[model samples]
Target: MRIAKEIRDDRTVLSIQEDRIDAHNSGELKNLVLKTLEGGAQNLVIDLARVQFIDSSGLGALLSGYKNANLRSSGFALAGLQPRVRSMFELTRLHRVFDIYPSLQLALSA
Candidate 1:
């Protein structure tokens, strides 16, 4: 659950440093996302380029973030997903529910 946080173009970008997001660390990730939003980030982007794997817990964590952001009228997005991770989202039909981008740059611009 090591994450590199930065503010870029008025958006808080959280780059997950780990390759896997599973039950072990999904809680940390969820907590981080909630804290970032509570800290007053108007927009948040999760950079998942390095994450090659994710489980249901991971997806649930992200969905929680998304819901929280919506409640606060903030934006939540996912960027730079690896192929396997992307497929998991697709298979679960969560991809259509999230604002996903191909790259961090594109996400920031949007």
Candidate 2:
């Protein structure tokens, strides 16, 4: 599967199971996230621990999820970013837009 879904406390975590989140799967990723929110997820967390590569489309999907969560009055966060993936967020300045954590445990606690 490209994604794994789980609920931890009040947060619904969508962990990307792929090595790369790019053009091919971005659309599907976006849809799954929105569906998760519609299914009553109060807090959304995108776990990128296994994703090593991401592109503009992937970033867009994340942003869409963030906006959708905000519209629903739910919180959104990101966790378990690999170093290169973390750098991509940093370079794009998306790090400022999302609450990023080093691990899922930290994100869950927050």
Each model's lDDT comes to 0.96, 0.91
**Residues 9-94 of candidate 2: C-alpha lDDT, one tens digit per residue:** 78888889999988999999999999999998999998999998999999999999999999999989999999988998899999
Q: How does residue 42 of candidate 2 score in lDDT? A: 92
TM-score of every candidate: 0.98, 0.96
What shift in Å separates residue 1 of candidate 1 from its native position after superposition? 1.5
Residue 83, model 1: lDDT of 93
Compared with the true structure, the alpha-carbon lDDT of candidate 1 equals: 0.96
Taking the candidates one at a time, how many backbone clashes does each contain?
A: 0, 0
Please report how far candidate 1 places residue 72 from its true position, in Å.
Answer: 0.3
For model 1, how does the per-residue alpha-carbon lDDT over 5-107 read when each residue is reduced to its tens digit?
9999789999999999999999999999999999999999999999999999999999999999999999999999989999999999999999999999999
